[model samples]
Target: MSWNRRSLDRPTRRIALAGALFCGLTSAGCIVIDDAEARDEAEEVREDLRDAADDIAESITDALEEIGEHMSDFAEELGGETLVDQPIHFREFYDFLPERAGNLRRTSREGATGGALGFHMSVAEAEYEGRSGAEVEVSIADIGAMPVIGSEGFVEWLDLSVDEESDRGWARTIEYEGYPAMEEFRRTRGDRGRAEFTWFVESRFVVVLDARDVTIDELHELRDAIDTDALADLRDREGR
Candidate 1:
């Protein structure tokens, strides 16, 4: 681990100021002192400052090392082989999506793979349309072995118990199909509105259900339509 410059440097500036003050006092003859004694006092102050700086630096480094190790263990536990095991193709997620969800029919489907910030991920996206051709999209991401893109920012909501309501709509977390999940709905004119359902599956795949002009029940219908078990099954098998 590297030391933070701002932290160490500030103390260093103070040490320099101390040295400068000593020189200014000597030059101005503000205090009479033997040259040898003055030299000994300055050396002691400088040595003390150096020791303090080293101590601070060592403490920070130790803390950072410990944190890095813990994060490494957590990351492996979170995704396991998905983090480093494979060259996963987005195509694996294609068949996982349903052709028909509720009243919506899939209009298009696509997949992509890429890397970013030293991490890789794969994504499968599908667009759905109702009889009225509204905006409905489903995205499934396998963060095992593709470019992170922006998917790295998506995090699992673990052990979060939330149930909130507003005049617009409501949001809550629930164990859907035994998986940690969250669903949010916002009301619009009549029964139409916007909604999203997020499923953090198997600690690897993140599935999102996004739609407009839909009610909360409609969102559940879409969520209920997908076989999330199939999605997790694919990752668990392939990851091993």
Candidate 2:
């Protein structure tokens, strides 16, 4: 009898050899084992091992999927509900801006698409009349599909101070209709000044108004003109 020892592992080879020896001793006459029988036994062992490996792989994959689901649930519980998919209309945000404020006219209007992570965002830009080389640019971004940025979180992130000597802008946190907001102002050389006001609505949408060669009063007016409640509702309803 010829045995292909290399076809099997050490333990399997030993078992096969033992079985063959037992069969030969129990059988009548000179027992003759062919290579085909050895090969068949080796193939069966390989199939069993492959089946076990496949089962283990499937179990691991299921476990990973379960873990991912649990993590997503935990995140939602900690960070509030996530927003849903919805198309944004830039004109809706643009309408929030006054058609005309004093001498500043709505010179140009445009919209752009932007977002981060798995979130969706609508960016609306409106430029106002400029004096000399300065103009006021207002941009409103309606972001969806993100965790809520609560007022407390906003306060922690809004801690910033101004550097007057460096002519750099300063930021101070404020509350607008019960929502956290920030305003910043900076002035460089003659007639070169900038101001910005930003506020988040329902911890989702954000409105930003920036001005060049404009006063803080103008920026305040722009901020006041926006109906934040309506804007917040817009985002909320769309998410639903």
Candidate 3:
């Protein structure tokens, strides 16, 4: 009878030990799996952030590139000594074009990317010699609302696009007539052009970039800017 009892106790002890060991291993495995999952999630989030930053950087670079390219092409057509600069500003936003490349005319003081009222720094010749076909025009200003009403209006007024490749959300015509002052009106207005910069938005306002070599009426036919649909789409997707 004693032997039987001992035998039964031994089997019970073994069963208890086996169950405890199994439960402990399962718990440890669960903890390991949880830790691994957390690490993977963190890695994914970091990668996403990096990708977003990269896309933004790329988009900004592309916009600047387009500006530079257009300026270069226009300068080449003028056939004169040209100077270019990246950093330029008026009382409002960053002046995208620092100076008129070939003619060194009045700089367009359009609004900034963040919605601000822009002022024309100076009024001068509309087109450089030999560069008759080049002029930057703003056609739309659809920036969101802001605290200052003037800023919003200015943003809408100065959102000019000369590069056809950037003609996705805005209208920018490049082939506008920049006139030389005719003798018929010399007595009244001296030497000035009838150039116009068409605003293609809800509120149509012609913000004249210069009143010297161009006329407001002649600038009505400025509609040659090309639409860079693919480039613009890529930029939009990148969130620029």
Model 1 lDDT per residue over 1-240, tens place:
001122222322333244344444444433345799887787666666666655644443343333334334445445433344442566777787778877878877755454333344555667777844356777676655422212332243266577999888878888877877777788776677887888777666777777888766666776788888787776544432
Instruction: List the candidate 1 regions with Cα displacement exceeding 4 Å.
Output: 1-84, 145-157
Model 2 ranges with Cα > 4 A deviation: 1-81, 114-117, 148-169, 189-192
Q: Cα lDDT of all candidates, in order?
A: 0.59, 0.55, 0.28
The candidate, 2 or 3, that scores higher on lDDT is: 2
Tens-digit lDDT track of model 2 for 146-203: 4433324333444443323344656666777877676667876553578767777766
Error of 2 at 88 (Å): 3.0
Model 3, which residues run further than 4 Å from truth?
A: 1-43, 80-84, 89-240
Q: What's the lDDT for residue 39 in model 3? A: 69
Least accurate stretch of 10 residues (summed lDDT) in model 2?
1-10
Looking at candidate 1, the ten consecutive residues that score lowest on lDDT are 1-10
Query: How does residue 11 of candidate 3 score in lDDT?
Result: 26
Which pairs of residues collide in candidate 1?
A: 114-147, 115-147, 120-146, 121-146, 121-147
The TM-score, computed over Cα atoms with residue i paired to residue i, of candidate 1 is: 0.58
Q: How close to the true structure is residue 2 of candidate 3, measured as C-alpha lDDT?
A: 17
